[model samples]
Target: MAISLAALRQMILAHPKALAQGLSLLVLAAAYSPVSVLNLSPVYGSAATKLFHRYGMAVTAILGWFLKERIHEMSRGRIARLLPVLAVSIAAIQFLLFKLSSWLGSPFGPVITESFTYYPLLALSIAASAKLIQYATEISRYGETIAEHGPLIASYVVFNLAERISEAFISKVIGSTFLLTRYGLQLVIAALYAITIPSKSLVLTIPLLLLSYTSNVHVPTKHTTAVLNERIQPYGFELIDRRDSLTGYISVLDNLNEGYRVMRADHSLLGGEWTKLPGQYNPKVKDPIYAVFTMLEAVRLVETEPPRPADQDSKALVIGLGIGTTPGSLISHGIDTTIVEIDPVVYYFANKYFHLPHNHTAVIQDAEKFVKKSLASPTSPRYDYIVHDVFTGGAEPINLFTIEFLQQLSDLLKDNGVIAINFAGDLSLYPAGLVVRTIKHVFPSCRIFREDAAMENHPAVDFTNMVVFCTKAAGTPIRFRNPVPADFLGSKARETYLMPKHEIDASAFETIEKGGQRLLKAASVDHIAAFQDRSAIGHWKIMRTVLPDAVWENW
Candidate 1:
């Protein structure tokens, strides 16, 4: 031990910059990996940047500045070997840190669940940064020709580039198995230090490192449904199918107790349908679990002057196909349909699990891009009805909600056409107000309705799912024609919710708070982002009620 400690001390004194460079790389990896991991969790995925950016950045900066001297002094002592241990510990604990959620619970649970791997790894990374700063200061005292801030500047540039590259490529490559990828990269970082720094702790770390690799290997995968099922089946949940994909972790889960199946992405549920339990099998269309989706179909029922032609003659364009409930309904009615969905895996699972009919034109791509391209092309098909239902993971994609995007969607509609948008947000918040105002701004006549039973009181927080039905005819009021029985398509969910219900006063959103009527644009996305923290936290609590704790924790 003494000999190994002596060797590590010699290397630290001789190669402090070399060590700092390595630590800089380690710090960058540690800083970014957690963001990816948090994205997998339903609680943090929406507001991850806001949650960690403020606190983690402050902690890193403060520790790097205040502890440089202490870190420098400690480097010469026997305790220095333990510094590398901090890096290794991050990968080790994450294998089971999610279990902390049961003890911690929502709001606080997510914060604590992330803190386990985030802070320790960050502290160690800061120590490495401190070492570089100290070495740079010592060199400057002798007045040697060195770019004092050059190392940091270069490190910052590389760190940003790495962050961007990982966001673009690495995340796409890692997909849904990000849990294992995150830990695997962490182990690689630790191994880099152990191998390069040459510590005697390798005797212990080597075995533990091997064990961590194995533990990570057994981490969930598409093939490991049985393992996850073993933990969640007792709670009446079955993992039907799951995969890592372009958008997020896409999975099909069946709540056996409730006799319903839901398609999930990260923490948010895309959509679900009531399943055929032993006594409740329906040979016709399966009913939807959420009324909002069924309500969206009311876009077809919007009354038109000269009375629109039969359903078979009208064309429908659907953006964001969630389990294909809305579009599938459109297809069932024999309407020509085009679906623009971002994730192909979502499309695949929706078809495979939810029985999405294969008759529609599935343009598997981003909604915004698809709209822009369709608008640019003179030959693009115009739609009689446009359904926009992109809300997922507790937050709306702000870009899709912007005025420019909505105007493009408006252009895609015929003069007499109608559109329905499914949005989930707290009506009491400024962001939701902005979205409502923006939709109203683009579409002259519109009506908003909530999914569930009406809340008697409009409190400080009213988080709920709603559908907004709008029309291109400026002066005409958006009214739903009385539905004939055929409109229900044999779905009980439709019979009850096929028409928009629990009407929300559009005027209320127009004049909400100060400038509440302000429209949302591409530049105003940040304004909405600033307020998502509270909404995301509330959404997490709501999700906890939707699924058993075991489903989320096991994932």
Candidate 2:
């Protein structure tokens, strides 16, 4: 009692209403799939999701209306003739929306399908254009020979459903696979299309699949922890800790020969000396720059009179703690210090492995939120020294560098307070220049210094660290001090670090105009995020040499 192929075909053909309903379901599913899948990730936030959802629904409604109008007016033969053209148009529009969404920095934006409203508008246009072209073609080709109203609507519905199902399946599979290999997904899409289309040749797809798999094959590399443990163990350096954070890697290495050294490998430092064991060897002079960190140490040399024993119970606020280097030194100096670090992993690894000062307070929160909360409370204690060193690898949190942010920081500082801000970047770039200019707009008196002196003043060098020392007082100046034996934690390594002789080249800051129209302030969180993607890309390139490409790829 096996059902014959002929019988099954006749049943499918005869039940036109059932076939239409099935196709309609497929079409609706395909149209809504992108938004459905996109919602699974929390990265886009509520504003973006709302925009996508609204537009997606609108597009579906418009398309539904157009399809209904076509069903009512067109004959079965005429409708059948239009299905292929409609399918191709739908595919083209979906791809276009994807491209446009990417270009606008979001899947939901003011243009294209970036907003919830815009997406449906674009989808409706696609559906209506597809339906109209299909209708015109059928009339031009078959004319009076076409059936006025039979099962043509059912056939068109089935084809439309198939196209949508194909779209959803293709988009999801490609999207999921793209996290592994972008080109591999492209090959997979081609193969899927080859298998689905009746007349298309599958021979070419076989070779492409083979080639893509070969190219994208993942081969594990040597573990970085093992390499670090083996190479620096003889130097009396023990690999005590390592942890990865959303921001970067925070590690702690202890040297039996000296004392513990806190290291922050921020996936952005290139050719720079890492303070811990497995330290970088013979780093190119142009490559290693620590000017910002050195400037942070310059807080010790502020021209204010030495604090009396009565005022010795001073508190310090460090906004961005990287491996707790400056704050570690501050705590060692007997100053009560509190560090506000956004990433908990950074704090955990820095303390466990980097041997950061254990006595200090650790507040894990976004600096902006913390600052706002602190400012709102007038009873908040003022900090004697505020070190704003938040630069991580290639990206600086733009909001942290804004004039409004600096103003809030200034309000939180004592009248005679000293602040050292570590700004790392290529000074030649517009972004860096803009940041420097913005800082100058807020602070009354400031002096900028490069972490390392430029041998020949080549501005084109891609990497460098700079520090800007700012004071609320109009005439305050900062000077560097030699590290004393007491400054070191009973380790000779302090001799090199205590009196770090990095010279300040103030000419670059002088060249930047103050209060100029070009000094744009980063006022919102959105502004800060706009730079993250590009900054991450730049940071990735710089970090490749410090840690092997395989390490980052694994993450």
Candidate 3:
């Protein structure tokens, strides 16, 4: 430890500017890793997500100032003499790094994730690494050669680069608000590796490294879809399809023996449909294999809420389009459905893989943004049924769940309208309690039902999915018509479970100490987030049970 510190001190003193540049690379890696995926208290998560740009830029500037002298010294060089020489040297080093990295990480040249923007950084990093090494060599004691330290330098660059690159690919890069932040984090690291060091050990380490990485390598190809399927084969499943979008990682997975085709968004399963197609397994009904998906369809069953319009005459709005189960059902039944989904990839995947209806209007935008616009327009159309099925990545959209957003949803509804809000969380947690209280406040006469009525026997299973059915009328009864086989579209599964009376009723649980039972306005939603962290972790474990661990890890 003492030798390490002394060596670090000597290296910093000798080539502080190079270390500063490398620090930027380290920061880029950290920001893009699982470190950014933390589930914080509602208030902290909101502040951190929204203000990341301001803080990230500030950090970059601070790193620059710390390494300012090396930049200043580089500027002092003889440009006329060094210009061509440095450019040639940088190009040569970059070509070498690309071959080595591509062989180890990508099959082609460096995996050009975004055109050639990041490729140039490879040249820049190599040049910087070379200059930094030259500076260190010049400062060393007269008898020692820089080659003596080549092994150590290679270890540093390769280890850090490998960690950052793997994580940036495996973990979602969601720290920055701007699209620019999504650009090559690995490119910066590659750049620093180019600029700071180009040692023989980097080239020599590939043989042992090649084995662990073979099946999971990602490089864009015309056969990119084929590559994803090949990658998941080792995990005992086939990746039927996958997409990287602004919101999160979305995948459609199928295992014939498991008898289901599941849609996954990061760690959470959006929903699943039974694999029994018309001929192969040949089941009598088109029933969903997952009960939670059917629970979302129950809003259509609210009988006492309104009387006038038929399914064709009434309109329905869906907030989050998870595999389009509810909206597709609405559209099929001849309801004029409009879906507001934030992620375009999700909308696309739902249409392609989950059989989402294309006949209705699709608004590929955030629910918050869409709601704000709808509220602004004087002639905005009202919805007879609004489905608030926005659960994703183990949590509901925080902004949309706020009392303010819920009230706007109320405004968008017709006077006799009914709403179904699907939320997943521990029944014992403040988030679940607060959400229930808030819905009751917004809709007056609402009843909550658990997705699995059978789950009531297990007190250990606190984290579960529930749908709240609410009506606009305060004093009116919010009841469901007994679903006949026709109402279920001939699916016995839906007829049996869609409108089950099993409630995760607020009255059943003990009162939370010190008002965890309190209603959450937009301002108080932060407190709910603080409590929701454990629930999210619980969700992560629950999701693992739904699929194998290897599948989630590879994804």
Candidate 4:
């Protein structure tokens, strides 16, 4: 039942508008793909939402409308057949150019990189889409007339759906190696145009498609780790393992010179620890590279209303498992612990590489959903200590910081239970204040402590990690009892950072009675998300200082 070439050509000619509509969808998807890829890089990862999504959409719409006449003219000539091939070629080139992020250092590199990647891709895709729409309009004029903007409106709907569909497809279906899926889609679009349009360009398109297949898709998939390691080896870093998970691009990177390993999710470092490799600074236990994780363990030391039960008799819940540093410490202390991590890959890597203890319950689910369900159940257990440390990618997960979510966490805690929340941001920003204010609104008595001392000559907008400790019961001030030798667990990091110091005055974040700052809820969380550009940029600078440009760029 294979259709002959003549019959296929007749079918396409009879339904040019349908072919045009389908090709436009493919072109729109290609346009949105680079934004996701750019987010995987350190240079553009922080500001990508604003840089590409909000502004990229506006640019696409304006360019699509403006290019209509030019595209219509092109559609009448030889160039129309080449537009699809050119569009697909640009998408392949954009992915290749993204590897040049190391060469394009920041201050203005992201601007240049975006110019090369998203802007050109947008123009080419829009031109191709407009040409298709022109074909649709011409076809409709010979039949039942479409509305003046019917095809244009339909293309816009396709554009909007492209973003959401790609997101779901990448996260749910493709998982790892989504870059390959993107490029493959581009190739399919090119082939579709060659088949339907009937052009001599097929001579160039077939070979070019094969070349892209071997060079971009095939070779990279076969030797991705080897290629990545070769690029980053000069900086004493090694790509241990990486996967595109439901959360983001998760990687385990090792700093050979420093003898430490870090788990990364896109542009942010989740957690890391010193290794016991030869010639390295050996310790009794693998010490945490970041002191903030150790500081999270201070949840246990907080004195309760009546008084917290002994470690053996207490139960704990950890909302986020970042290398299982805090939860491992809690398990070692004999606290019955339950970890609720949204990404199973994080939990798996924590166990495989970071040696997370297996004694605790692992609820691999969203923290908010877990909280909601637990609160609904009559048999829901109350935790003596709950650790909420879900901050990542230069901004906290906005949903986790909402007043409603905080109240649920409060409900899940025993009457005297203590919750330690980790937040990373500049203190001067309104978003930071909004989060702190919301926490205080939920918990009447709370205290804040920075992981380290404020640096000398640091910028006014200091970006650092801080933990907020609060209690379910009010009136009594939240205080930490002195840690004894047992609390150290033989690790030097815990010995030093277990006691929270550098207390930030909780009252400092307090909004004035009429300052207009209010608690974050599900509806208003976007306010915090929208203002994270500065904070994320600040964090990007900090991460660059932590690891070399080559390490981030290669990934």
TM-score, every prediction: 0.87, 0.53, 0.68, 0.86
- List, in order, the clash count of every candidate structure: 2, 11, 11, 0
Q: How displaced is residue 337 in candidate 3, in Å?
A: 0.3
lDDT of each: 0.71, 0.50, 0.59, 0.71
Output the better candidate (1/3) by lDDT.
1
Worst window of 10 by summed lDDT in candidate 2: 282-291
What lDDT does candidate 2 reach at residue 200? 30
For 1-555, candidate 3 gives per-residue lDDT tens digits of: 123566656766776665554444333333333222221111022122222322333343334334434643765732112222332232223322333321332112222221132223323333344444446534344324444355236534653575466555544444332222222233333334445434444443344234213422221122534655665676657777665555555678887665678777766777777765555443233567777767777777787534738889989999888777778778877899999998787888888887786789999887888999998999889999999888775667667777888999999998888899888777767677767777777888888888765453666548877888888887886787777665676566676667756776567543555856466677766766656656765665566576665465444
> Best by TM-score, which number?
1
Off by over 4 Å in 3: 1-188, 196-201, 205-213, 217-236, 278-285, 454-458, 515-517
- Residue 184's lDDT in candidate 4: 48
List, residue by residue over 133-213, the lDDT tens digit for candidate 1: 445434343233333454456455655565666556545565444443544445555666565455676576666666654
Ranking by TM-score: 1, 4, 3, 2
Residue 200 displacement (Å), model 2: 21
Better of 1 and 3 by TM-score: 1
Summed over model 4, clashes come to: 0
Stretches off by above 4 angstroms in model 4 are 1-43, 46-50, 72-80, 87-92, 99-111, 137-147, 176-222, 277-285, 456-460, 512-515
lDDT of prediction 4 = 0.71
Which 10-residue span in candidate 1 carries the lowest summed lDDT?
Answer: 139-148
